[model samples]
Target: MEQRIQSYDALFELMPEMGAQKELLGCECAQPEYCFTHYLEPGYKEEDILVEICQSVTEKKQDSGQITFKVFLKVSKAACIFYKGSYNTLHKSYAMLLQYIEENGYEICGSIRESYIEGVWNKESEQEWLTEIQIPVGTGSLTQCIC
Candidate 1:
């Protein structure tokens, strides 16, 4: 697949609000509607993790209430895989993607992004859910994985 950098303006919320679906809906945005939860920290633990909950905005919008506007950019080369199944089973798909990256001599260079393509709003079952896992890759010779 062809690699391209993507950029979007998003609304950010912290911790508890980050996972609040209702809160995200409050912000208005345009087409190809979707939401993104960016893990700002390494660990996925709930206690003190920093996450940026974002939705694509056509034009730069002002932050209101708890929502703060921020830019989300995916730079460099990227490898993506379409995952079909429950979110609980995402780890398996992620492992497969990471393995493919390593075997192909590409190193992960940034935070992993899970884009929700189809979910509860449309699909009736978790098994029918679709998510796109996008991992940014580096072109350098460094073998270290930064993801």
Candidate 2:
């Protein structure tokens, strides 16, 4: 089988338009416990982060006040790493992952995706939290370089 990146469309529970976590709790959502909170931020900046939750179903009907969206991620090639630690130390992992991609002849092509596998409620220790970093990449080529 070809070692190609896999991409997919997913339903995401988004933060309220105002980007308030407290408002999210007030919004009606079913079985919120099963959802894992994910963050999308530009360049790992804390202030730029947007909170979201991955949904189990793609066609889930949202309540009147619910904030959600369907998004598709295209991952043609990528460098992935599993991180186990506090969110505060993710910069270390990101640095290492970026180095790995550069050494392997791939360049980041899109926004990074951090999927929280284990977190606060499930894990007591900050060191036990699990996160997966998916950095979309693409092979360098003259065609790409020209543009």
Candidate 3:
């Protein structure tokens, strides 16, 4: 597994659906206490700290109470560990990614972004689900992580 750095602008598009009220919608690397509101505005690049959002969705029928939701995250530049196993094996993949980060001299600047690339409602096939574990890094920032 390898991590790649990428700049994203459309991340804000998902905020409303996720029910984020007062939180700064950018990366979690910023100090959680101080909410940076304008950092994500157009052309404000200096404050672009590494950010990630863990996203998940659920659906249910009106009669039955069996609701299902898939959870994942999206992050800036970090390594990725793809797994092909049951959902119970997620922890092992996480530990492996952490080890890789430590070995490569990178720190987790903030919280994790879990992106649910595939889910039940989105697809008829339930055999596959895609997730991304994004970890912040020291390089490649529009601005920088101050907290």
Candidate 4:
């Protein structure tokens, strides 16, 4: 987590204007998230974690040579969860979402993205932090069963 902040600091050093709101490539809002971590997985390996710490920049100027960027498009159907609380308890939320995805018969097609909506900057406590988790799905679309 500290590393991600350090990267954000590095990004800010390269582009100070990032302090202002701007739209990111894959994000829907103009307000930038503190950081986005994508977990690329059909299933995560117990021995290793696949995580990418990154943020979206608006224009070419904000993008420096030191940074590498990628643009991801939205998927046809996504299973989303809005979580509020400390980062430590995030695993519980992930469990809920993953279970939902599995039960609904959705095959994850892209990276699982976590975008911070609010946190340390605005709220005093970690309990107030809000995040959105989006998992892209495919395989003939979702069919929710009440069984």
Kindly indicate the candidate among 1 and 3 with the higher TM-score: 1
Give the count of colliding residue pairs in each prediction.
0, 0, 9, 0
The RMSD of every model to the true structure, in order and in angstroms, is 8.4, 10.0, 16.0, 7.4
Reference-based lDDT, each prediction: 0.63, 0.56, 0.41, 0.59
**Cα error of candidate 3 at position 5, Å:** 31
Q: What TM-score does candidate 1 get on C-alpha atoms?
A: 0.70
Q: Which stretches of candidate 2 lie over 4 Å from their true place?
A: 1-42, 50-53, 56-58, 62-66, 141-147
Q: Is candidate 1 or candidate 3 better by lDDT?
A: 1
Candidate number with the higher lDDT (2 or 4) = 4
Report the Cα lDDT for candidate 1. 0.63
**Best model per lDDT:** 1
Q: Which lDDT tens digits does candidate 2 get at residues 1-147?
A: 011112111222231222353344453334433243444444544343454554433343444343454445445566889899987787899899989998888876666767667866579999999988878777766444221
Superposed model 3: Cα runs more than 4 Å off: 1-76, 123-126, 139-147
Please give the distance, in angstroms, between residue 71's alpha carbon in candidate 2 and its true position after superposition. 4.2
Q: Residues 61-143, candidate 1, lDDT per residue (tens digit)?
A: 45655566677654657888999998767879888988899898887677767787787668899899898888878755555
Cα lDDT tens digits for candidate 3, 40-111: 132213244444332322322132121112232334465666554344455677788888888887765555
TM-score of each: 0.70, 0.60, 0.41, 0.64
In model 2, what lDDT does residue 37 have?
A: 42
Q: How are the candidates ranked when ordered by lDDT, highest leading? A: 1, 4, 2, 3
